[model samples]
Target: MDESLRAFLEALDYDGEPFGMFYTDQEPPSGFAPKPGPALSMELEQSGAINWQEVWGSFSCVIGSIWLARKKNTAAYFEAARYGCMGGSFYLGFHQPQLDFITHYVSTGIPGTQVHGERYLRSPETVRRFFTEIAPRPAPKRFCVFKPLSQFAPGETPETVTFFGRAEVLSGLVFLASFVTDDFEAVMSPFGAGCSYLTSWPLHYLGQGRLKAVLGGFDPSERKFLKTDEMTFTVPYEMYGRFLERWPDSYLRTDTWQGVRKKIARSRDAWGEQAGQGDGKD
Candidate 1:
């Protein structure tokens, strides 16, 4: 098997169990972009009853090029080709039900799948540059960028924003944006008011979310409402992994982002106060 396939298996933790690797590119190898279906599914031959309570994760690996893989989770693998086969297997990707914490994945295959994820998320522009310059195999010459950078809340440093620390902070926010009925208080608590930084703008087609966009927009019908004029980017997962490599203990909470989150809360508080004062007779 090709190392990409082997490394991909290792990254997925595939234990030689009877499972198939489902693949569908986001864009065509040609000039046309890939119109990813809302869901990518497959049927497995009879193998008992597919376990419905296993883990389903969309992870990116960091091996060769950046890659995205969504592991089909089933405590029990389906039945043989057909024993008493009579069933329907189809569900919305978002509605499929999750067995563990939902984590973001890489759109491109990564070099090291065992530990890291796809490479695209690591350093968006630089990674893209790498693909253009150091790509082992030939690929179409199309590219994407994060919307917030090009436009929206303009007037800042050209290269790096002075405020934001890690781009994945926004990367995490991008993942949260996918939720329709998101709990702002709960979601914002982890990353802070940084949501305001990203939420106000729209998503570009670059970052890691490109592969399984099976769900389309986070809000489904939201494209009609262009909140901001930003390009949706496939997640630069390689950028994300590079971040983790640099900051090994990434799980620790950040006081800086916490402070930023608090400031947003304060701004909201101030806005409420101003609104109340405006209503009173002057």
Candidate 2:
């Protein structure tokens, strides 16, 4: 494991849930429990904060619904999906390398009946193509990736990391990174697996231009986690929405999709007009 990752693991509360570090000058909300760290800077010429709650809620609605359908447990799976959606947005997205590692594990690991597992098994070539395509893209120039830290300061608490950036672009990066790595086998392994979802939280404001945040996954598996590689991309929010809207039909049983749709509809009602809506500014 890398020294930074080792240090981060050492800092964990042990009893506390897994956590990732965020680097920013802004005073985070009380829930965020900001702590002192090295002063880092970035040049984000074209980035800004978007309505993260809306983005997250929509993502949860779609993804959660799918999980619900697959697991055939509306109550449990929906809650997990809700938790994942909120948690991912709160964290500054998953590290690209971590996401890639998880993808590699799933694409090459055992096959199963779940959507992610079966899909990869059906088209290993397609999965390979995806990784190849994303591997060459540069990390987001407008965002700073945070180091994962396990510990919270004496008074610090784990809370959402605010991100500032183009919602459409960030959403696309997150969605694609997630899509290619949705490996169920790793997730079901006794060793915990990295999360597939990513969120872009706002970190700080630098005069006219604010710094955006993007972090990666840190699971509690016994395996030693380390950063291996980096990849990033962007897809329009509208495009993501369309994909999510069609995902269940394409991958799930009709009966399951119908049941899941009802839950999604309820979530949409609660989140108002933005729930599951496209990334195009409302």
What TM-score against the true fold does each predicted structure earn? 0.19, 0.21
**Model 1, which residues run further than 4 Å from truth?**
1-233, 244-254, 264-282
Q: How many clashing residue pairs, candidate 1?
A: 65
Model 2, CA-based lDDT: 0.28
lDDT of 1 at 40: 21
lDDT of 2 by residue, 95-172 (tens): 222232234343554346332442332344555554443332222222212212233345432222211122222333
Predicted structure 1, TM vs. truth = 0.19
lDDT of 1 by residue, 179-211 (tens): 321323212211101111121111112232331
Which stretches in model 2 have alpha-carbon errors above 4 Å?
1-27, 31-94, 97-101, 104-108, 111-125, 134-282
Clash totals, every prediction? 65, 13
